[model samples]
Target: MQYNQRTDFRSREYNGRLNMGVDMRQPQPQAGSVHNDGINRQPMPPRAPKKKMGKWSRTLFATLFVVGFSVFLAFFVLESATDLFGLNKEDKQLEIVIPEGINTFQLTGILKQNGIIKQPVTFQLYAWYRSLSMPNKKYRAGTYVVNTNYSYDEIIYKLKSGSTKDETVNITFYEGMTVKEIANLLEKNNVCDADDFLEVIDKGEFNYEFMQMLTKNELRFRRLEGYIFPNTHTFYIGENPTSVAKKFLTDFDKKITDELLERMKNINMTLDETLTLASIIQKECSSVEEMKKVSSVFHNRLASGSSLPKLQSDVTINYVEDNIKPFLKVNNQKMYDAYNTYVCEGLPAGPISNPGIEAIKAALYPENTNYMYFLTDKNGKYYYAQTFAQHQKNLAAAAKAGAGVHGTTTQQ
Candidate 1:
């Protein structure tokens, strides 16, 4: 091939071959320079320099990656820890029974089932951490009354200590006891002081609408007089006063169902009025059958345009006399107390006693009869009459049967 004017003929001979005898000082072609036919061509654009990394730069890159990864891992662990431990939830009093021979895994399940704890795994993890600190401390099996208000540490400590002082106390209230008497019974049982119980009954607020309505009436001797259901109750020994009242009121609410409320409404009576009549029937009657008769007599007197506008009940008068013997003679002069049904035109102001469900049902569904007079004698014999003359005859028969007249009264 013919060489161009600007071509270096010696450089062409060394192309694609090693030449040990080539001139060392020959001017080198710049990087990216273009050449064609050995003529002098335009120089190409200069390339960007390759960056060189030193020891310190490499170490900085490695440290940043490690720190970023560690921070991300720490944040993840914190989020998991929060969920595992029950934190920032509503507090409630929960009673749980932990059986004997149960492992930590099983105990965590029980606590979660009872709503005492939120997370099972978190509880286990916390328990594990605690066990590490106290190698000998372990949760004992028993009935545990735990409150959500307690912190995780407090709850864990309490479980480890095996405290059972929070056991429930049993309280029994008998039928026909007044609120005052009921308070005394609670005091005697060491459930609470009598005065404290009375204060709670008077001032404590209740959730039920029926109780809310009664709270408005200042004339009520006890706001929840007939509503404190007379039954056996088991409550935590140091239970709140409002909580104790709620237990009895809750039982009463269940007993006096919507069906019973509708019945009272059908008869054009309020709960207070119905309970008042039931209390009278409760005290006047000796048996359940007698209750129906007594309820009828009161219903007959309460009828529209009845000749006897007032219910001449001896038990109501006895209530005014503070339940004294010879109740008929205890109050010769008509008392001004509203509970004195003999003096009051209609039913008593409120319930004289906490009557049972039977009496309550009797008042709601009285025996339909024209009988306006009823008498229960000392021999437990019952006398019913439709007129004054028939009533006198029945009383004479009761006298012949060796039965004494105790609650005999004349209607005004």
Candidate 2:
């Protein structure tokens, strides 16, 4: 039952005398055998050579190990020696351009290729260590010019932080652009979205807090389209896109000067009417001269005691949809709804578009004029008169000019 058992014979000499496997009746050796000691003379199965180590071997190995370990520790502890002995350019700058969608192991290889780090395995080890501290180290992909002067620690720090500041570009939007126009401008500039931006502008069902953001003067009418002042603004780091929009609206309120408001009040035009007129002025005039002329035409007409006191204009119909919808192009017969100047008696419901300061100023200080009727000549010059009969004469003159220019009589 035992796994290890000793031989039954006293020694090998006795076992050898019996030759092959012996039966129980085999004879034993004599008492005075040739053996001097009770031992086997067939040479004790060569005792395993003593395992004592050689003298020089022990000393040599200990010396080599001490020197090797000193070297390893020296490299590990001395920070500067990492670069001194490692396979990397001592003075080269790492120009790394990380394309999109590569995993971290591939990223380590890229660092190795650029000589940013000598060993990919060591780089990975450090990256893993960083991952332990911050599992989510998302550095945006970019082209970087990293100097070798920075230590491994600092280099990794810069790559992970991705602190690239885009050189700022200045973009300016005029005060009177619709939200759609603003969205288009932003889309063109590659900052934020056009559609989502439009959503923000359209989200005019403001809650109590944002409503409270308005000064009382701004609250005289609905919405903040024309209220945002237009000027050249340069955006750089720390420019929150959303906050910029809010700031624009705030600046708009500032431009609505007290003098302009007083002028509107004195003339008995409601703030709504003044802003509406301003909006029309903004659309009609490309220059200060034209703006003042257009403003005078409206102001004088409004002040007139005639039954046709309405400043009926085609722009009013376009303004009816609030300019959020596209501009309308309808025939006069179809436009004969109350929105039609030929049918309706007064101004449209709201401002057609946001009005800039120049437009507002023009509306406030209209040029004094007696022209009750005006028409665009063939060349877009204004031809003015005081009576319907005279307006007809101007129209006929325009027709004659068109005929003279084109050799055809106009039929209207």
Candidate 3:
């Protein structure tokens, strides 16, 4: 048994292999290769390098984005501007009521609600801008008629002017009407109180070149007796007294043109004196032609030296008796003497009545004549004379014609 040991070991090894059922005869697959039962195996392909965009492509994309954004922004701005400025709106009238004492914000809100404005915020901004320059300017409250197409500036101006709903009256003051008559008319029309208007006329401080030249004579009955220009005017009912007086003065200021001022200077006549004479002429004559002739007679008497120093106007006596005496608390003999041309030398202390433009012109440019006296009959016919005897004849003729005589024929 010892001599056959090597052959026995080999026989044991073969038996151990058969018992385990182990086989090591298959080939191994390489790395990174697919192995599906080790049949038809293949390797994976390598990845390609990534490509980068060129400079021009990036620039084009950025340019397109910027252009698109700019177009959108421009369109937005155009729309906002159009609405803010009230451009291209419908032309339709709209009536709107603005409540009293509403501030700028409330005003714009009302406008927006009424379709009068599209952008309230922008309108308020504009109002604030204007307020910096005109602090006193504010939108007036009341019902107003506005157009839809009006610009912001126009809308603001219209609102600031006044309300259309306030009561207004048209008063026509005729030539030769005194301040008292004017006051009575105003009170009759419910424009203002007559006493208040007279108070303003006596004391109100009016600032005008012509008014500044006036002398505040205590003897003058009213401070602005003859300066109130006669015209048709519009006034608010129950208006302020000062405001009512200013309307008449403002018109007078405009009526005294540069040419008229030069004419007054050429004739060596002060404004008060010219108005005084014009007022006399206004009351004495019945027609424009008669006014010129009467103005000539007055001028002749004024230049007559010591022979005829006093105007001796009959109208001045009428003014004292008719206008002054009735209103006086006590009979002011001194005031009567100052205004009565029969007693006072030269022109009366001031104008007796408000004269019209034609009378004023006649005072400045009198008809060239040697006539020194004039008389008017009840029929309104005028007779002129150069001598005292001739005036007496004209007076008798006037008396025979109409049973009444009117002129400066009374003894001075």
Kindly list the per-residue Cα lDDT of model 3 for residues 1-412, writing each as its tens digit. Answer: 8659988998888888878886546656686555766565566678897878889999999999999999988976675577655688898888888777878898888888988788777788888986774478667788887768766755765676564434689999999999999999998987766887897898877789998768678889988899999999998665656678889999999999999999989999989989989999998876997788889989988898888888888889999998899999987999999999888888888999999999999999999999877788889888888888898888889888867788774453
Worst 10 residues of 1 by lDDT: 323-332
C-alpha positional error of residue 392 in candidate 1 after TM-score superposition, expressed in Å: 1.9
**The best candidate in terms of TM-score:** 3
Q: Model 3, which residues run further than 4 Å from truth? A: 1-165
Clashing pairs in 3: none
Please tell me which model should have the higher lDDT, number 1 or number 2.
Answer: 1
User: Where is the poorest 10-residue window by lDDT in model 2?
Assistant: 403-412
lDDT of 2 at 288: 66
Error of 1 at 115 (Å): 17
TM-score to true structure, per model: 0.58, 0.48, 0.61
Off by over 4 Å in 1: 1-164, 215-217, 304-306, 323-335, 408-412
Across 191-239, the per-residue lDDT of candidate 2 in tens digits comes to 4446545545545333333344333332122355454457776643223
Question: For residues 98-217, could you state the per-residue lDDT of candidate 1 as single tens digits?
Answer: 777777898878777876666566677877886774577677778777886544544665676565456667878877788888877766765555766677787775678786446254
Ranking by TM-score: 3, 1, 2
